[model samples]
Target: MPIEQGSSGNNNVGIGNSNPNAMLTVGGGAPLFLNQGASSTTPFLAVLNSAYPTDARYGWAFYDNSTNGNLDIFRRNGTSQGIQFMSFNRNTGDVAIGESSPLFLNHGSSNSTPFLAVLNSVNPTDAKYGWAFYDNSTNGNLDIFRRNGTSQGIKLMSFNRNTGDVAIGESTPLYLNHGASNSTPFLAVLNSVNPTDAKYGWAFYDNPINGNLDIFRRNGTSQGIQLMSFDRNSGDVSIGTSNSNGNKLAVRGTIGCEEIVVKSASTWNWPDYVFSKDYKLKSLQEVKEYVEENHHLPEIPSAQEIEKKGFMLAEMNMNLLKKIEELTLYMIDQEKKTEQLKSIILKQNEIILNQSKRLEKLENKL
Candidate 1:
């Protein structure tokens, strides 16, 4: 190959070309290459070997992509192969590690030819920092971790791109807001299969029209079924339904519980106060009149009110107790009246007996 030097004073070199604009130019449909011999432990194009002795030990080396089609970026460790910082498959344009094809290629689960990894066979246990994405060949799961001056790498999340499922590790997502700024704040995740698949997935989003946060499950491309809803206006929550109209919590179906405690009972005035000395007891006639007029007990909520506003658990319990205590008082008063009537009847019977005895003595005298 005849080499020609540039006419300019810069002394630019050109191969197979008359003119050269750069330091060196090679033309004539040929490639510039370094044939460092087969299995040679040497740097083909070394740069400042004495200055960067450590980096130069396993750096600036290239291989012909013929045998396994792996082009390793670095050659580290005392071994000739060295730790592969990154490797690329020239034919498929896929990234891999350990000079081997990714396990996902044979498993046929991941996205098409999506493989990017970092592997160190020598120090396999040592964690790599600064944006190291690893895909476990054995587990067949992709993991992302971050090590910011910490002893252990925090596995941020694991994701299966094909399934579009992401599992969070120890770290959790947080929202920070101190004052009312009228900022519409929310977090949502959506996952779905291909459009043709009948079995669908789930989604969480805000319903602007209804003022609710909705979590729904989709099935067979139909309108999603709401699994849970949180009312933004009233702070009410509903399960198996969209709107919790009146109550703080509403369930479309029955709720089964082993034990239920009315935790807010302290806010209610218990009905034991009905027995206080200052309390006035209504007569039975007055109660009868009130019942006839209102068709419900006094101090008790009507059916309409309960239907619209929803009954308070603690307050209703206390009201029922008050009615029970009132009934007890009525019973006690009736028992006293019956006792007086019985005494009067007994006295009358004794007087009649004395009168009969006196009449008998008078007849004997006659």
Candidate 2:
């Protein structure tokens, strides 16, 4: 080995070439190598050491004695020495960015702040242009933030792994919003086509004026033909504006089903009051007179009224039952009167027969 040292003030040392600008330089095709003895406490490479006892010191390529001789970066502050900023598992090749103990690749851990923060660092005033990931200790959720030059970044999204629910643009998202704007917050699903489809498969539109959420399905190119709508303010549902013309579960086409059942609870007011004794039953004569005057049964809606306003089936059925009950009462009264009349005729006939027999006996004597 040949060594050439420069003059006392020049402070230059060259191994193969002379006139070196650096303090130490090696020339030729040979490579510079450093060999260190196997020690868990010593570093293989060190850049700069602290001159004073109070200054903070940094080093690279240090062997960690705590992690079973794992290679790591060391940062020292005063008498305290540790791998405070970063650590690496040489065997596993797992790098921890801001954690002393990394469980996985790119693992970040902190106590009072975000576990991971990616900063732009291009401009200090607008330096909040990045992302942050942290656990929300307040709500016990995983929150992801998007920085917009604010002190605390805006929470753009969250996820609850336990419930398997992901929230976007809101802390607690019941549903997802595609167009998350203040003016128009809606979602649209488009159909796939060769030349690009103009038809929407489905769309959810938010109506701020009515406070309704309108869901639309595309029949053709007509967008926002409402299939259904939910009113948040009044809790009303509108359906089939897109398929049919009416509201509240309207359908254009015919529906085929095995059975359609409508259950009316007992709390519903039924028309059993018509059968009560206090119910006023009109006489047959009065009913006939009324029918002749009005050309319709009493308490029944006329054809003209039915045409004007649709009839309710339940109400009409009750009215018809009342009329039937009235007819039954009339029949019972008429039957009793007929039986009494028949009895009187039979008694008169018997009396006439007896008088005839007595007259015949007098004629025979003469």
Candidate 3:
């Protein structure tokens, strides 16, 4: 016969270890209430390797819904739990499984993929940095999760952990190359799907030719302009070098203004014509008729005739040598027939004057 200890130290109720603390608190004649360790001397159980049991041993004394075992993941020494909850062994830290333990996994409880899994097979140190990956799924891609160093959560792309650089989109997208310097300005490539060819993308250089950040677009050809800088603030521009004093200077084709205003001929002369109400122009047909009626040219000597006069003037003692020489070159360029016509008019005028004089003399004789 197995003799068991009972409560009520008087009258030899025969409870073993009559010390009040040693007699485990029994509810309904069973030891299952905040008293798993009441029979033992230890106060709390130890956890090893972040797991309850070191090895795969599992066991349970007893548990009921009314008990506090389901309250928290871990509890203090004096907390209430009617059952001897499973724990790691004091030596190897493996779990101790009772013979009649239930099948925990097949208990119809929800147990699927875990919410977080960190495998640092390469590095064995602690996860000293913040969260490296959140919501990392099983898609077989290299992924990272990011967080603010402080309380605030992640602001931008969260899961990019390439050092000395930052990347976005499916393994790589926008790459900011500050690998040269962690603190200073950096270079970047945008919309880059492939780093080898860098197709359909642009490159950027911070603190460019004359200390200006330059943005360059690439297509079949490449074109670039200075965007901004610590020294100069210009958009779509190219900056020149500084003088000995180290001041910013504008290069050629870098205008000061954002846009240039071009004016048409009519609008440019608006001040002169501002008061006019309307402008008028006759049609092409009217213009043709007017020109036909009024246009006529008087008969003139050829330029050759005028040049001959220059030669004759020298012979007749009328022209100086300098004048004749000047006229010769002028005649070559000017119209010659017009000059000949003028000479003919002068001769006719002299003949008319002589004839008039003869008529007057005849009248007086009569």
State TM-scores per candidate: 0.52, 0.39, 0.28
Looking at model 2, residue 255 earns an lDDT score of: 65
lDDT of 3 by residue, 226-297 (tens): 333334453334443222133343343346788665445442322223123462333445546765764521
Off by over 4 Å in 3: 1-163, 180-197, 207-209, 218-236, 239-366
Per-model RMSD to reference = 12.8, 15.7, 21.0
Task: Give one digit per residue, the lDDT tens place, for model 1 in 1-366.
Answer: 878777886575666656643345455333222333322233332221122212334333444435565554554454454554454556655554443322112222132112332333212223433333556564555765554333236655665545544544433322111221212223322232222223345545567778787766656444356788889888899999987877688898889999998665456677788789898999999999999999899989898998897677777888889999999988988999999999999999999999999999999999
Q: Rate the local accuracy (lDDT) of all candidates.
A: 0.54, 0.54, 0.35
Q: How accurate is candidate 1 locally (lDDT)?
A: 0.54
Candidate 2 ranges beyond 4 A from true positions? 1-185, 188-200, 208-211, 241-278, 311-314, 337-366
lDDT of 2 at 325: 72
- Clash counts for all predictions: 0, 0, 21
Worst 10 residues of 1 by lDDT: 173-182
